[model samples]
Target: MSRNVILYIAMSMDGYIARKNGDVDWLEGDGSEPDADIGYDEFYGSIDTVIMGRKTYDQILTFGEYPYKGTRGYVYTSEKRDNNEDVEFTDENVEDLIGKLKKEDGKDIWLIGGAGVIDEFIKKNLIDEYFISVIPCVLGGGIALFKDNNPEIKLKLLKTEAVNGIAMLHYAKR
Candidate 1:
């Protein structure tokens, strides 16, 4: 079977993934204890590869150790960079890269994002599944999850759930 490209991300109720400055400190739940699972472990296990934009990769580096250990990572960037044990940086076209990966024998791919990569994938209609977790707060203005001027793509809702005050919505291409 073809590997699906899933956009698994959390966004504010106002549709912002992070603050304008790229701070994600607002992704907390209740603050009563440590962060809840929110199905992350389950979802992470279902994917064997992760794709992200250059900025997103840089941002993730600030978080200390890489979170995706076993999964292969691909970082889209124009500049030349050395590959590491965890991820390979490539300047390949979005459509071409995704097409090749889909044909490979592996589990679903995670389209983890920054706005640029997400916008490209959405425009190409390459994403197969979307797992969006809506956080409780609203960042009046920030990095938007969806950019303007993109073609309207329809989706079929697969499931919905609430965990730790966050709304999780699963949808697939229609």
Candidate 2:
């Protein structure tokens, strides 16, 4: 059976994943190489598909290297455009896209993104699990990591650890 959507992200105490302009240079330098790899590799290896928003896709593009291999990525957007043949950008309804993904034989789905994208998914109650690492630092305001409409989310904490002045929390929706 294919797994559902999983949100794997790193955030600050102030809830900003990056600066207002999408600059995460500080995060790039502060992360522990082994811990980062362990967390990322674990999530990526389990996910069969990844769904991201346009802004998140653009941010990843700026990095100049695609980390997605063997797994399919679908970018949800209201506008129509071409973003490489590898990435599929669709303006279709969210449920439709999710339904399509459910039919495919694969591992879990990854919900990688900026706040807006994550919010949409959270609001729709589509995210099944959230793997969050809280790093040290307060970026006051930028973009929130996870902002939902008081959706009554109950998280069953599965793991915890401190790496480089940070605390990682792995939770599944219950």
TM-score each candidate: 0.95, 0.88
TM-score of 2: 0.88
Model 1, position 19, has a per-residue lDDT of 97
RMSD to the hidden true structure, all candidates: 1.4, 2.3
lDDT of 2 by residue, 63-114 (tens): 8887785668888787888867568887777777777788878789888886
lDDT of 1 by residue, 15-101 (tens): 999999999999876554356667888998899999999889999989998888889999999989999999999989988998898
> Which residue runs of candidate 2 sit more than 4 Å off their true CA positions?
28-37
lDDT of each: 0.91, 0.78
lDDT assessment of candidate 2: 0.78
Top TM-score model? 1
Q: For all candidates, what are the clash counts?
A: 0, 0
Residue range with the least summed lDDT across 10 consecutive positions in model 2: 29-38
